[model samples]
Target: MSGYFIYASLHQGRPALEIVDADSRQVCLQWEYGHSASQQTLPERDNPAVDELSESEIQRLFRRLLLLSCRQSLHGQDEPEQNS
Candidate 1:
């Protein structure tokens, strides 16, 4: 996966961060959100034609993205208890 291309793809108004290997297969490290999107900075989503940033920058971005997803999932877990 060293030469794999990591890209942000959109489908049905959602955002998906994909890593495709040299064989054009989704090898590993895929990220996505249902009903949400990939943002450049904030309040935006799905930059399909964006250029690739630095590796360090991408690492930082993905770390933040994972953290946010965890927080959102925790929030959703609380909803069932509240409704009950």
Candidate 2:
């Protein structure tokens, strides 16, 4: 309850997954889909203290995002993957 939580929400009218700090209730990372899928850091109105997060915490967030992506693919959403 004192760490980060992942939420499925909309960011700028697009489907998004957000990693929010439970204590500050601020978004630290966001993965959103629009013309393409992309990841943004500190997408909220005010930036969260991203520097405070440890490397493992950040990795956890990315792992969760990957898991969600895999699930979406398994469901056959027809979303195209973008190569950067």
lDDT for residue 12 in candidate 1, whole number 0-100: 60
**TM-scores of all predicted structures:** 0.32, 0.33
Q: Per-residue CA lDDT of candidate 1, range 17-78, in tens?
A: 77655444645456554322444442323554333323344565578557645654765632
Top candidate (TM-score): 2
Those runs of model 2 whose alpha carbons end farther than 4 Å from true positions after fitting are 1-53, 79-84
Candidate 2 lDDT over 1-84, as tens digits, reads: 345687887766756677776767887567554222233434453545434333444565678668756654675554665799
Candidate 1 matches the true fold with a TM-score of 0.32
How many clashes does the backbone of model 2 have? Answer: 0
Query: What global local distance difference test value does model 2 have?
Result: 0.58
Listing every candidate in turn, what is its Cα RMSD in Å to the true structure after a full C-alpha superposition? 14.9, 15.3
lDDT for model 1: 0.52
